[model samples]
Target: MSSAHALMLQGAARSARLLEETQAQWRASGDDLLLFAYGSLIWRPDFEVEQALPARVQGYHRVLRMRSRVNRGSPEAPGLVLALVSGGSCRGLVYRVARHDAEAVLTALWAREMPTGVYDPKWLVCDTPHGPVRALGFTLSRRSANWCGALSDSELLHIFQHARGRYGTTLDYLLRTVDGLRAHGIRDRELERQARLAAAHGLCTPTI
Candidate 1:
């Protein structure tokens, strides 16, 4: 093949190799775990989960803890990150897997939730009926104009209560959360109260 054709062929080969490696990683991880969804993932079930239930995790509060990196991912990109709002506690659901499926499960979740370094990963303790579940979480990286420290309770709820994105709006996410919780036969008072406060405070206003 010519030099130009050779280079192009090499690049394609490398891309295919990377994809194979990624799939291998997923298969190796097996199943039986999941990262909680305190934010947008609650609404968007892009990643396939064995099962999801309303459960609490500890040491992190659900803060509007992310910088909105629109250019990186959205309808335009693919992945999305609602950074961990630091400095508080977050309560959300614990998605269960098959114990040997962490690799594939996480990769899928990352594709849907965190496509790139627009947001980084963090380890948090999850409060579950079984016990504290350690899982990976997606949060805003320190690389964006929208990067802001964890927003206060009022701020978080306000954003979700009235935020919108390319795929949908903030209100849409909140509405989904309400529905998801109800489906689990649970009512998240904290989230519900935050939604109320967000409405009262007005979500359209600047939260960060």
Candidate 2:
């Protein structure tokens, strides 16, 4: 494996710690364990969930700003992924897991989302049709090494055209996210704009 890939595998301890702390917090609340899903998780949750609800979280919005060096790209040609950054509000889904199965479910979730420790998993207040719930969300800080900041249109186009990892190309990932959000009745104009731009540049078929 590449040194970068090896380093990514080194986050197991951190993932375990975060999972432990989150479980403790959930236990203290004495409620069903809630997890907020955005991007790929919205469409392809690999874990079992007792319930899923459309939810929105304030004080954070989704952005295609995190650098993906493994799943969607590589060390030599990193790709972009969605992350919840500060400000505005985000519409997504909240998944509830029974307390009896929370530990196994969260452990698998951390393995999927926390490898390399790029996201900060936190409990955020999510507003749903039923009511408000505190759900664990994976957020990215601007100060993180994986933050991509604001990239120019040309730069994004290049990544979309060239970056690919074990999972697939960057453009495919973007298209999937757009479709996933649309399926859930959530429209992110910025994501739609990106899809349009990619199509115009012949990176992939038009999705918007």
Q: Write the per-residue lDDT of candidate 2 for residues 123-207, one digit (tens) a residue.
A: 9999999999889999999998899899999999989988898778888888999999999899999999999999898777775
Model 1 over residues 23-57: C-alpha lDDT tens digits? 55435556455667776566566656777755665
The TM-scores, one per candidate, come to 0.56, 0.92
| Residue 93 alpha-carbon offset, candidate 1, angstroms | 1.4
- Those runs of model 1 whose alpha carbons end farther than 4 Å from true positions after fitting are 1-31, 69-82, 99-104, 140-145, 149-164, 182-194, 197-208
- Candidate 2: misplaced stretches above 4 Å? 1-12
